[model samples]
Target: MAFNYEQYLRPGKLPHIWCPGCGHGIVLKGLLRAMDACHLDKDRTAVVSGIGCASRLPGYVDFNTLHTAHGRAAAFATGIKLARPEMTVLVVGGDGDGVAIGGNHFIHACRRNIDMTYVLCNNYIYGMTGGQFSPCTPMGDKASTTPYGNPDPTFDIAKLAIGAGATFVARTTAFHATQIDKLIAEGIRHKGMSVIEVLDDCPTAFGRRNKFRSVVEMMKRFKETAVPAATAAKMSAEELQGKIVTGILHREERPEYCEQYQQVIDRARGA
Candidate 1:
């Protein structure tokens, strides 16, 4: 049976503008499935994104949505959730928008333990603004700006989120459709800040210059590099050196910022 995305997808938004081999569509599909599984009310949900090719997601979804400024999705989502604490808010954007340009907001949001979900589509390169090396871009990966090789080390998004105080943190790849959907659903169900780093394919900008050969080759590389947490635990640091750790890295209860702030306000009024 074909899973109809029509209900989640806005009418007249068909034939999404993403590149042929781009994995944003795949991630969107997974997100939709997760939403369906969670049985979340679209009317009560808000999807927000920043400026980027991946940030175009909010326009295609049928929900209270926002297309915000570059690298400010987290900030915008934070405001929305605080003002309307009853609503379910989800922030979607690419690696550059969330990590590079929006790095500070991302950390603060996590630290506050906001009641929101962050979907970070990490294609390694800045797909919208040409292929520039992003924070998640591998140490030696080549982008348009890094023709020879990237000198700096890459950011581990899952570790960053966990360290920054995300109540739930998961990592999955576009090729792992089922796992991606499950993680997103779990993230949505969690009360405090949740971050799901989705490793995706940027065939045009990143793939072409990086010598990935083809989209299949890149996906194959992801599959080869990814290992489950249970399996990874058995392996030594040297053995798991360059592998992508997939699955829920961390999940725990935390006090949401809005609730804490409300309590402070109530106490002040009582005093």
Candidate 2:
């Protein structure tokens, strides 16, 4: 609230549609704060999102915003960054939109090392269509689709980003507001592909079904489970299980996709 993020928000979209106690708003604010902190030019920034409760954030921000097709936000952002390499492109999407149907695109984007920042809102359930289990949903978690419980192993998106060759990767929960802002800012500043996997809460859809009594309880759980990378290094794997390791998990300097393409163009023109 102290931050002047409101200035970057679209006044016409005064009222948002997210359910009460949902953590998407917190993630949105962190992104805006990061944008302001990084001194990014709003006019030169493009905010891309896909279909979902969390994806609606782009509609509220005053930028070159694109609310693209379901599970295709990253693909759309890829095209934007390729065309306007000078512009700062940021992507916002839910777990379902980013890693479920769009998982392949997400993987390739990281592998390509395109210059962009992606804030993947992982609420562990599909909050838009229904409270169904998502790719990040923990095992034994019950949902509308998984009445008995989710039997599939959950994905740690940070590891996926690292394995896929993303140059920057980090994770922070919505409750860690200040930390998330810093991570987002760093992700924006990184030259290659960066992904900040935000452990956001969907109180209305996921919390109600996952034994979370209230939003406060859900946020408190994140604080209880989160361990910084430095601290996690000392803990045993058994002790670290079920804990959310929050911070910059991976970073490596790599040739960015757009810049690499420009080299080819420069060579072709000379020839």
Query: Could you tell me the lDDT of residue 83 within candidate 1?
Result: 94
> How far is each candidate from the true structure, as Cα RMSD in Å?
1.1, 1.0
- Candidate 1: what lDDT? 0.93
State the lDDT of candidate 2 residue by residue for 181-237, as single tens digits: 899999999999999999999887889988899999999999999999989999999
Give a tens-digit lDDT track for model 1, residues 19-85.
Answer: 9989999899999999999898999999999989899999999999999999999999999999999
Alpha carbon RMSD to native, model 2:
1.0
As a whole number from 0 to 100, the lDDT of residue 231 in candidate 2 is 94
Residue 193 of model 2: what lDDT? 98
Clashes of each: 0, 0
> Local distance difference test, per candidate?
0.93, 0.93
